[model samples]
Target chain A: MIMKNDIILAGVGGQGILSIAAIIGTAAVSRGLYVKQSEVHGMSQRGGDVQSHLRLSSRPIASDLIPTGAADMIISVEPLEALRYLPWLKKEGWIITNTKPFVNIPNYPPLEEVLATIASKPHHVMIDADEIATEIGSARSANMVILGASTICLDLPFEELEQAIRSVFGKKGEEIVHTNLSALRAGRDFALQHKNQA
Target chain B: MQKMILLGDEAIAQGAIDAGLSGIYAYPGTPSTEITEYIIASKEAKNNGIVANWTANEKTAVETALGMSYAGKRAMACMKHVGLNVAADPFINSAVTGINGGLIVVSADDPSMHSSQNEQDSRFYGKFALLPILEPSNQQEAYDMVHYGFDLSEKYQIPVLFRITTRLAHSRSGIERKAKRAQNEMTLPGDLKQFVLLPAIARRRYKGLLGLQPQLENESENSGWNQYTDGPDKSLGIIAAGLAYNYLLENFPEGNIPYPVLKIGQYPLPRLWVEKIANECETLLVLEEGMPVIEEMLKGYLGNCLNIKGRLDGTLPRDGELNPNLVAVALGGKMIRGEEVPSLVVPRPPSLCAGCPHTDSYLALNEAMKVYGKGRVFSDIGCYTLAALPPLEAINSCVDMGASITMAKGAADAGLVPAVAVIGDSTFTHSGITGLLDAVISKSPITILILDNSTTGMTGGQPSAATGRIAEICKGIGVEEEHIRILKPLRKNHDENVKIIAEELAYPGVSVVIPTRECVQTLNRRMREKFKNKKTE
Candidate 1:
């Protein structure tokens, strides 16, 4: 069977959601699957909510936007942003998100309420990705961690995503690439552990 | 052949380059900015000696592209939908003037106001100008249409309007490449009076354009981009245009759209195929991304015999962008109900950067204008316009580009002493200079605050045309040299900036206060590049 994954990557501006989309999109293309990724730019980049629709399939894709309630997964770099796109998620859709909050706006809800709302989802894996990335020696690789957690929902191979990370981050040098790879593995390990326990 | 992933905008740019484009003129706006940026970054474009640069605004850009076409070289002018409003005069006249070489005007419409002021469609503009329009259904089609658009422009001797919306313009997909073609050599029109739009010449040119309508329609029918695909079910015939066609196909991923479909990529209404579908199906559903131009045309002003369904008949939402789910619902598919978002998740509006110079400028202005009270300030479009939001409601009105100066002048004339105008450096160069000249001529009692951030901050830090020349331009515009004040907009210089603004406001004549600083985003980018270079060394 040909694999198809419709993922929505959500975050505030400057959270590197486009980077995640680029990494996964490049990996999907290398696997000879057709990929369509829709991004938000311009005025929305000034600390506003942003999301990218990423679709990968064996057959040719049609629309650049993924239909409402058809997304297989939503990988968010912020806790509140993860909940913001719940309307796009399937009933069984997995929401793998970072637990850290991007508190750019005033009147931000309590951290516990945001966490509880995300936990209420039928299928969700919340990880302290920033902490894990910091532990992995690259504070900026938190997005890589979220991408790793999403690998469980994606149809592509883990090794392919690893290679994609190298291809995308290769210019930054081998150390940065290795750190991001480690962060990805740590996230995958956390999600796998949670899934096994469930 | 190698394939590369490209945004819809980039695909169009690459298509133009491969189609032997000699130059591309554009103003930096969302979704459309990347088109010119791609050409500017391409080594191939450099090797081919293509002229790609940001113009002051869309009007000058279109005229520049028209001039290139007059010289018998293929050129392109791109802008967002509202930008078309700025370039409407030259754009409409370019069709009457026709072309010596191919010219494609790419207007990327923002259907949902993603980053724009309005969601106006560009197809109406195409029809109004009596020019051919090509709306691509996908990135590959966006790539291929440039070649066809240029050919049609050359053959018809008219500029082609290439329309796209936010989704397609910002989206990315893989596109295949074609062999490159050579740019046209410099040659003029055979007739010396071709571009002369005097009354007598214009009448003959208008007649010539009218005569070409049939050929344009025939080309549209046979364009192969517009197709009539028959299906087993004949209950409903779908007319899907541009990105709307993609949404329709997405609903039927099995490649089995039961209804007969007329996929329309080229315009002039392609009557024959449309007639075929209308004759076959019981009902007609027009799926267009923007307005109901096709639906209204097919249904006429009165209701037609066929059950015409679309934005008009309430089959789809009357406004906003059409997504696959909405198309699915229109096609009688089940509406999937998902989890609702908690009300606690408030809206996150876009704001200025933390250390934005606009904040300091506004702070000083508020302090200086305390005695005068609120609602005396007018602003223009730029990052500084964000001051209208909370924490600093510094600006009162934002009408359009260059309107700040003129509006402030009018207000100051109407007994509002010391009326202030806050405009950006790029916006000043774009349209504010003329208004300043008017202020100088009338000696309007307005204090113009030119926010000189050394770049266009709102549109992601494109280089400003007013850089290093604001003072000279102000002086040349006849603002008194003594009253032309420049101050650094920073917290450290807040009191000094406020004193200067107060002094300018106290003056009865036209005065300009320029708060000069580099945009923090661009400064950071430069710093990072410098650090990278040092590391490399």
Candidate 2:
């Protein structure tokens, strides 16, 4: 049996990708799994690309960074981010990502072409998480939606994940707490319902 | 139990509040700025009677906190490790004078040189002062230790030093906070002679400190913070300190590393703990962060009996932070490969934020000083200190807070033509005033340029104490009214600022030039708040 699970999250700036990764990392820890989370928030505030490494294990974790192609799962909040981190995903590992494009510089692959290429792979699931986030409330919470949708495949306790979401936003205020929790559940429901269709 | 999320620095501030701190004096520096800021922003602190304010610099902060302790009220002083270097005089002397009420001096250190000038460990300061030092592993212990620290201080009647590095100071952790304790009532010293630090009394106090050495050693020996645990193998032992202990415990394979572990927290190197570990094991690995202080202390105590290994022999890094993998590798465990970070170009050094007011001040200073000659600009630490960096290498010297005025005075007294001291308003008040007084009384012919960007900019824009008083202070300090000039610092008004600076530099008498500008970061933040408020309305 595998002793640990490694997940990679990548995105462009101004997306709520960090929040999504934090929630997953927190949820893993709450479920009694040893978790190590690290991020290069960097000059991301300056509109740079952002990536977070989240590793969960039954045993103790050491480093914050993960080794190449060691990720059991790669979840990208942005389309190009998914492609950018493609090499880090383990052979035959699952890639779950939003189809939204966030191009900082000019001339990247067209959104459809990028998605088509990723879908041609044996292990990929694409969703318009931004639309899902907007329907729920704010498009910023799309990252939370991505985490919520990816939960089914995460093989962790849903109740504990809910607890983690509540824990992070619970102190902010009631409205924010409810909206994020709703976003999380919506993402989860969407992923679970579409697993067979995909 | 009330569960709350707190920043590590905020937890320390809350810890001080919970521990019944009557007063806290601090000079703002990154990683340690929040401790003073949280206290100032707290309604509870104001209502429950805690006096929290930014002193001019670390020296004044230390001196003021010591004065509060003299009145027999619980007090805490806070500063970054470099600030400790500035406050070292009072700090070393405080150990000799001892304390009346409980006292805890917090030195928030920045390891890896994050937002700091140097990574000098505060544990060395603790050892130098021969005072008890406490290093908390995480935020929870940071809070608990603050409370425990005061009690320990009062029990020992010696001020305790609480050291937290950048990682522990910035990391978020859940802390279960308790109700605030009642404040200690003001009490006069029973023996007034003890409070008076005249030479005779100081000598007596120095003797008292010396006599208390054995008791301090005993306290370290029996501290609840230190513990020992048996491991799978008696052949090897682990000596982990502070956060290193947490990392060691986390990486212990099978919850059983082939070593007995001695977790040391209380300092002066618990001889008992070291002896027990050394006697029992053939090989011992020392685990600690930031410095080799503990390993050095152990070498003297444990000798070469145990094959002691740590930062000294590259068992671990002497600088930067420790993670579980480093501890794991030190314990002869399997090497855990980490993600290779994409190689990027060398990072650009931090410069002044775009449109910062200090930019205009530097522009003016750079232009004004060129006529006199190169290397005439004397500056001090503040946001204005960034003027020393590239593109605007305008400042000649920046020793510490208030050193600009004094240093300029020294140069002028030595007959250096057209010397000028450039300092921020917050820095002027912090250590600049006394130096100004020195110039005024001595009639030193130095053109003191008080850069009034009405906030402490470098440490994230805390309120500059001389908001509306810089001009008044210059007047009150006996600066000739004719020489006290205020010019708006703006690129549009750049000509006027430079003209004023030039006029003052040529003046034979002592002069004060006030270049006034609001901190751009503060203005931007306020404008956003105003927009948000208007939308709400």
Candidate 3:
């Protein structure tokens, strides 16, 4: 079996982008699949852009960068960043992006314009992740929300994803653990409800 | 026991704790910070009376660990790749002054310049010091290596370096940990002459280090971590090192590869496997991260028939960290899509955190130097260096720690008016103090702004070395008390601080202005702790 999917997740630092990619990668690997991941963050503490690439398959991943037009999916936590990586998405590939942009990036594309561009694509999910997160009790967790939304297109089982999340962040604290688990469930539910609407 | 999830760094710390480490001393740097933090916060570690604390800098950290080792205890000194340069003077000399107990130097290298100035390979340092180096391919190896590293250090009577790169240090994997080992009995150094590095004794210890090299290499050849794989096909052999070998195995669909594989984790190349793979295969690909040091060495040993290929042959990019895709390309397989990378806009450079004291200090410095314009102020490394970017381009030069003070002095001596140096509290402690002493002795007409944020600030605000005593140290170092000025750096205090800065800059002789404030991050942490304490109280 050939390993074919390359997934890139990009957002400003402090968005929990790394954790999201890590969870999905872990879930895939736990199922006896091969996975490779690379992360790039410049001064992560200062809130700069952070990008992580996850390549998944039954075989070993080859490249660190999700080459242009080769990304099976690009899960972005911010709208502008999703547009930033738009050129990398395959013609029919899926993009799951949150509507609210991180306030830090000096100049960002307007939310609607970004939504319109993503809508132009064949397969896309534009989520008001912050709104969903705020309803779920924390806007800081839009990352998991987007991750959950993207799972609609990925081939992994929901149980596997949940197990990875529990294993990864369960040590953080019970309250935080419950809230984020709720957020992930909310995201997956949202995606399942509106996946084909666009 | 249940499989507990652990970061590679945490696993190393767990392994150290399991190995009954006496202490962990380190200067916080990315990829290495979590190791020290893990030890400090671990309940099991603290309950076992293990000591873990942030050292002033990498040099002091290593020296303190050496001191612990000399007292017949296992000690770990952790530092990032460049921090090793700061600690190299002691590191190289430590080989000559052998230890009484186990000493493990944890060097976490950033192969892609990830949060670092350079991508230097520290494995070379191990070879240069004639020290046995154990590299782990995954988190389990990282943890297990620490325990094994201590045993090896004790067995060989030499310090061992546990080398990890960004990937191994940051990645998370399932790690099966062993039961805790009993602590080594504390005993003082037997021979005073052995600990002292006087020329006579140093020469003898140097000979001892050299004598142990052969045995170390032989042990490496036989190490379980170093494996020789035999498969059905032998057309093209692969010599994969560290995590690259793990990445390579993913490419083969079946458990067996089409060629013989020499997966190396121990340093000082396993010659037998090299000879075996080289003699059988027509072409060999050397896969490793960072530099082509191993490839260079392999080429010399293998005849022309081996046809060695790696970074040196442009099969791999000579720079940046490697991933499996890069290794697959070296193996002559299809590159990861072989598609062109989409263009990305040049990223906006990193800036100081919002409400950071460095931001306020930079603003005040800019306001004070509105007349001097852009090119007058010099700065050094630390959080304040971020002021060189947009919104507050106050600093002019930053070349390593302590360069600001000395470089500004040189410019002033060469006739630049109102020359200034701005260094963070942590950077000053790292190297700026001696430069300040130089300014005082020379009486250079330079204004040095010691931006005291009371934390390192850049690498997540581990306690600043000069947190409690920059002022006293400055006075003790011979700067005139009258020439030293201190001001609280805050938005409300900005005007007063700027005025104080102006007055100090106008002074004829060497002047020191310390704009003081606790880092906002630290302040928040303190606030949280205060709230927690109130509840407990």
Best by TM-score: 1
Write model 2 residue lDDT over A35-143, tens digit each, in one string: 6555542123233466777778887554444555557878888776776666567766777888887664444556677777667666766778889989987777788
Q: Model 3's CAPRI class? A: acceptable
**Pairwise lDDT winner, candidates 2 and 3:** 3
Tens-digit lDDT string for candidate 3 (B76-143): 99999888989998888887887888999999888887687789999899888878788888777888
Q: Give me candidate 3's interface root-mean-square deviation.
A: 4.8
Model 1 chain B: weakest 10-residue lDDT segment is B297-306
Better of 1 and 2 by DockQ: 1
Which should have the higher DockQ, number 1 or number 3? 1
If you superpose only chain B onto the true chain B, what TM-score does each candidate give? Answer: 0.98, 0.90, 0.94
Per-model CA lDDT versus the true structure: 0.92, 0.78, 0.80
Question: Candidate 2: deviation at residue B59, Å?
Answer: 2.9
Error of 2 at B106 (Å): 1.1
DockQ of each: 0.84, 0.14, 0.29
Top-scoring candidate (DockQ): 1
Clashes of 1: 0
Docking band of candidate 1: high
